[model samples]
Target: MYGAVLADGMGLGKTFQTIASLYSLLTKGINGQPTCRKPLILCPTSLVQNWGKELKLWLGERVVPVVVDDTRADHVKKSFQEFRAFGHGGKPKVLVMSYPCFRMHKAEVYRMGLDVVMCDEAHFLKNGEAQITQAVAGLASAKRRLLMSGTPIQNDLSEFHAVFDLACPGLLGDLKAFNKTYEGPIQRGRDADATEKQVTLGLERMEQLMKLCNKFMLRRTSTVLKALLPAKVEQVMVLEALLKGIKASEPTDKVVLVSNYTEALDVLGGMCASHGWPALRLDGSCSVKQRQALVDTFNSPEHPSFVLLLSSKAGGVGLNIIGANRLVLFDPDWNPANDLQAMARVWREGQRKRVWIYRLLIAGSIEEKVLQRQLAKQGLSKALVDDVGQQVRTFSRDELRSLFRVDPTTPCDTHQAIKCSCSGSLQDLDSCKERAAAAAAAAAEGAGSGAEQQGVLGWAHLARALDSPDPTWQAVSDFVRNNFVTYIFSDHVIGETQHCL
Candidate 1:
């Protein structure tokens, strides 16, 4: 329970902060006990070398680090034994390992107790049932534990509960109690059927939980570094430009083009191939070795590759690709963290040029709704560190419909432009609540035309259904027909096929 989550946003020097704290703790034992304690760092395979490099840059010879080798079982055992042997004497030791290695040899790790256990990119264990989460949670022998992630809660509150349970176990109670106490009411409160009183109670519970969680989590965004960091200009590259296969007009700058789906990567790859652009592609299909090699090549000035085609899931975590100053989000992701992390690859510490982020999205397409969802999610996370006593904003059914109000006549370039701006303080919570209440009331009354209502509510219902734990095709179809057919798609399309749903 002594551990806390350092969830500072990307490009905010989480590694430096962590290293500084560890150096202080290991050098001067807690309460002046003069204890020589060994700590272990668990991170993604892609980040193992990065951790080693950062430790050397920050701490130098003050603390020796042993990077666990997973080439062979014997080699791993030998390295762990040597690491443990250092606990008796010599400079203090810290073991650096990838999650895969830790999962494979968790029993051995438990036997060799640790002073502190730091899990980097901790959101990887957001699935409580995952083997990695189970393994990490089983490390009860560690005296202190820290879970670090820029995005600790990715998709929902359940994921948040998983990481919070790791950092501060039993604080939120078990998963079932947490859902009953907080999640259920909050979710139901978002529905159009919920009463005003129910909504108010749900909002109160959510605020209480956020305030309680914020106490143990230290979060800061790039807003604090606005003056120090160069400008990051974001623009919308319309579907037209993307279909035509746009290229960087400048010759010196390297480009990192990302997509959430691999199909898009393949399409982009074809475009790059047609243009004879020197490029490297990475996705879930690539091995760990291949990914590291591709990253190294992309970062090397000697390489001719200027375009790096990467899938968001593969490149979103623990990557430092500052060699590239330009980024193109070929497609938007439901989880904004993926896009944010991809952008950070180029806009981080070693970057010298003014960063350019082009987010390609079609007007009135699914991407527009996704953008709205991303904004809502961003607002939720921002509320955590915002000053207390301010009203917190949460999504409602009608508000979700409003997100789909994109003008279909306009081209995406003019309609979907994303301007670069510095972060500001949260809006008055009371005003947000009033707006949401009004919108929810409007939605409940079915005030809009059948077409408008269908277009709006159809997408919102689809989003809600997708997020449900046990979504049924039949239920989803009935929802659309009952709520959207008269306003949006006519009965012809709605009743045309059962498989479409």
Candidate 2:
């Protein structure tokens, strides 16, 4: 079975790419059976209709799109029967259903013997233990699997493993083996006390892992597609400066203000509404029906709404509102992908005007730190896909201190790009500590002596000991002596031994 992930940046047409892949497969028979090919696409409930619409628009008359409606139990049962006997009586070649509906009919799905399966916004399956994950994994008959997500690694490398494992199972090895081989070293390299050499080694391991997984994953950023994308002018404006500018703008100006928090949306919406620029707001609470109507109204110039206030998550993916060329990111999110997806709404394919993306930040505030973190994550993503030679740096003390040094009086320099460093969620810090404690326990158990009786020590113990009134280096040597394990993969794979540092 051939499986892969199309992790292109938001608005880069992953939907079209998957469509093209399916078309190619339909023409070029899969495993020498062209007539028996049945492909299944699973997506969020909010996107089921959109998927059907897009499939119809792109592959009209070329392939049949079998859409499952989850509203009626009888209709769902009838659809399941139809899907089980798909291709009979000249039926469609593709079956599209919302993830929720698929869950309800998982048993039927498992029996459908789908030839190919694709999951849009595959990050929903990042949790390996989730019922949906297990259900999707149960499609053992699928010959090919495709996962599409913009933010596959939202929090940690384990999340990356979870997504990649689905695309190419065992390509990253088992989760435990992956953690011991890659996660542990890469994390230790990010430790505050890590030496430059250790960091370099960790990065090299990460690069190797990325290189291995590169075969199954295709990721392209907007920068790479700059020739196709409309020119995007990104500006950084102070929050107060943004307010002043908004106040000066004409009521007819089309704008979309994006924020991570509802409070900011309320404030911006109120300000815009007060200025006679009627505003429409969409957030998590907005229904799928409401979102489509709002997007349509906002996109049409004839509509009364001039300013659309959007919460980042609700507007992130699967919804394309390309009417407004001017957008302001009123606040930043910890994940860079969210911001990227939000900004892509205006800079997409149908956009005729040059897009203006403004990021509003309070000078020297936590917002700046958040932006820095975002830049770092973006750089890391680039290194993994576009440029492996790029250096990925951990947060340094000087960098931390510089976050506070931006002059509040000076207009924030939007033109200057932040030097890219590599980082992810601080949750890894806790995971790293846990790994070290496990290593310590392993050491103590192996020693079988007074090490346990005298009081077992781990990296945390050593970290505390180093800062104590009387620092000790003895534990460091002891730790090294205890947990070290070296082994060659096999006699055939000679001269190289794998061990954790």
Candidate 3:
């Protein structure tokens, strides 16, 4: 049995490559047996149907797409068991299921005796403790395993361990040893020289492990698939602004601001609508149905709309909206991965024209800080394209002072400032000290208090809440007896309390 993962960059057709690999393996017999045993492709719920569609297009009539949803659990299990009983018989049987469904039916899946399991967007199991990871691990004991992800390791190298652990257990010793060697150092950023040394050694160990698993694994990138993709272009639009309030009051009045969506819509809507582009408004407030409908409209040629207003939270994952040459990120997300994924939405296959990515930045506020953090995370030098990827620049005291400029009128004592300079390192040290002090204070306060802490309501409480009888009517009667507050007043009180909380 062998397992492999294709960790390509986003917009690089990972799905297509996985499909191609499966197709080639199935078409050619392995060890005198057809290399298909009802391969299971596990993915996110939003992408389940999309996977089914892709399978139909790639495998044609040779494969059957089993869509597993919550309502048809028994039906799905019976069908899967039937397929397993029948066996592939020299053909492939592909079962498409979401991560949640896989968790709900891992036993059935294991009992059905699947020959191969392919996890799409495999990063969902990055957290080793997650239920999905455990379920996938249970399935990994099967004959073959395949992991597919664009970002196989994000934020920390240990994420790679989680994927490999599922695909090929015992390759990495365990989470503890792996973290001490790889994850701990990677996350320590620029300060961990000892950690970096460990990382260097760990990479070598990883390479050796890869060789041990060589018969089962393969990795590729989008650059390798360049022949299959169109040219792409990214554009950055910078907006400059200064503090609108008086200098004296600016420090106190500074607000945590985000782009006004209503105002943003007027601007983006005009640009996209002018080009006869259909607009897809995707935000946290919109329901799943609304988001999907917008995606459908955006993908339709009859609509031909280019403008898509996407919320970072909702559009960050499992969305495959494509074919718009232009992309406008109305606001910046704190996480670079989130922004990258959003940008990749337009850069996927079938996009013939150059993809133009427009990042709208509000000049001087936290937006600039957000952009700088994003660049730093990418191992780039600065926030702008010119300064990126050169050399890592350490901030001096004066430079740090300039970056986080305080209004001259704001109270500042030169004597007090002498205690700690404004260098980045000094600021970090001060932050650590402050956190320690706060923790000490909290500990002291908690120790002094004799209050008994109550645990959260459990499942029994939830069941009782659901089954309680006459409680609603009794509560209403008690409320009237206590104080004949008008229905409007009671409603207002409840609404106000909910809003305040």
TM-score of 3: 0.62
1-501: candidate 1 lDDT, tens digit per residue: 677888887888888888887877787767765333769899987777678778988888888888874547997888888887844347888899999999998888888877688899998889999999999989887757788888876676688788888888888999999999887876565455677887777677777887888788888665455466655655453322322333324566788888888888888888778877788987888766567668888988889986888888877788888778778888888887777788788877767776666676665666777866775665444433332222223345665676646566643311123321211112222332333344445445643222112221211111121221121222334444343222111111121111000
For lDDT, candidate 2 versus 3, the one ahead is 2
Task: Residues 353-460, candidate 3: write the lDDT tens digits.
Answer: 534454554334455455545544443211111111112323223433454543333222221122323222222334434433443343356421110010000000
RMSD values for the candidates in order, in angstroms, are 12.7, 17.3, 19.9
Regions more than 4 Å wrong, model 3: 25-29, 69-91, 184-231, 238-278, 282-296, 380-501
lDDT of 2: 0.65
* Cα lDDT, all candidates: 0.66, 0.65, 0.52
Instruction: In angstroms, give how far residue 16 of model 1 lies from its true place.
Output: 1.5
Pairwise TM-score winner, candidates 2 and 3: 2
